[model samples]
Target: MTDPFFLCTLLWFALSIAALARLRRRDRQAIQAQIRQVGQLADETNELILFLDYSAPGFKEIDAFLLTDMPGRVTVVFHAPQWLFAAKAKRWERHCVVSADCLNASSSGMTPTRVVLDKGGKYRVFYEVPAFLKLWSRSKM
Candidate 1:
């Protein structure tokens, strides 16, 4: 008879893959939800929308919202995600920072021109990206 160990190991591997696939699908759906929400608010004009949360290190889950849907007319940058005072949030934050390069125009010396305070102690930074950079950023992204 064939060794049961081999069958058991194959079953374990299949289960692992299924679990991972489920997680990936969930994550993809979450990201799509984010994109859809902001996409509804975007217009086919020369306008920039900045998003953030109502807690410390806001812009917590949303880094940049880049939408190639409308191309130059409307571009969205979903800067990944950010931390939210929890372990999962911390991982999300790291993801945003690392993935935001597409639309994140900020440099070491740059700073926001205005700060918008939400209900909580958290805050949002509103920086006006240059007109030239908008096109360049969108095109490259």
Candidate 2:
């Protein structure tokens, strides 16, 4: 009787571990999906800007300002829908310096920009900047 009970307990433990592993895999997949979505959005935004025949004023002489200056003073406007707020919040919580400036533009109507020093070079995670001027202008009105 005792042996049977022990076997049952061991089986339960194994099953529990399998379930936990599955959950962890699912969580990882979800995080990867979010990362990809963010990348795609950034790319689309860049394409749209380039399609507009506009350029990042002043930084023209420099090549790839986004990759170089991103770790320093850089601005990212969040346009992900409301449903993605939780994900954005998670990122903000993970990144963003304690004294980071969070500024919400009066025109954008969205939450303030979540600024942070890209210590881990993760800004590369985002490869595009949307129509900052247009968005700002529209938000102001």
Candidate 3:
């Protein structure tokens, strides 16, 4: 009786491991397929894109930037790099200001960017808000 019980337990354990391995492989394939689709969409739209792997070990969301969900795990895409800075500012409860010189330097990848917060006049700014709310408010009286 004891021998039979032990044999059954061992068999069950082995089967569980095998099933887990199969599920992992399937999940990986699904994630890969979704990533390919996202890449295609981004290319078609000609927009700057960023992909965040939430399922990956040691994964951390970027300090700023909004993520759009397509399925398995999560993929994040930003309209522009400047949006990232704006998002960060929003998170920090601060305002984001961009100057032509700083923007040019950062985007051009020609020189190191220096952070300057001085009392100045008008400058470019960016902010984040719920798209639905924005559209809804615009439509309302």
Candidate 4:
């Protein structure tokens, strides 16, 4: 009775929404568990840590822009407060990066954080975006 194209589009739309929701839920749960283990209450005052995930093909084939996934690369970021940064240094939680080394790489979008994994200016700068929103918004001016 209905156009096949329309039905396919509808199904894709529903699937897309579900995927987004699922990603959000999974990300939130991971963050919450980390916060709990780190002994920090999830509050609005200050974010204890922020998680950002860069999904792509693979590291070797990852593009500088990170807009597409060709060979498959995923760089997950775990950002933490300055004071507590050292405490999490040894944990194999994720691709962890200090807040000092991260910045909002977008003019828009839900405050996605781009963390530089390299220690100093001497090495190649890797662009990695985090998945969660931090408590404080940077570059608001």
**Candidate 4 C-alpha error for residue 56, in Å:** 18
Q: Stretches of candidate 4 above 4 Å error?
A: 40-141
Per-candidate TM-score against the hidden true structure: 0.36, 0.34, 0.34, 0.34
Q: Which runs in model 1 stand beyond 4 Å of their true positions?
A: 44-141
**What does candidate 2 score on TM?**
0.34
Cα distance off (Å), candidate 1, residue 130: 18
Write candidate 4's Cα lDDT for 33-126 as tens digits: 4434432232221222333333322322222223332122223343445545554444333323333234333223333344322222222222
Error of 1 at 106 (Å): 25
How big is the positional error of residue 87 in model 2, measured in Å on the Cα after superposition? 19
TM-score attained by model 3: 0.34
Give each model's clash number. Answer: 16, 4, 0, 9
Model 1, position 135, has a per-residue lDDT of: 44
Q: For each candidate, what is the lDDT?
A: 0.38, 0.35, 0.34, 0.37
Looking at model 4, report the run of 10 residues with the lowest lDDT sum.
132-141
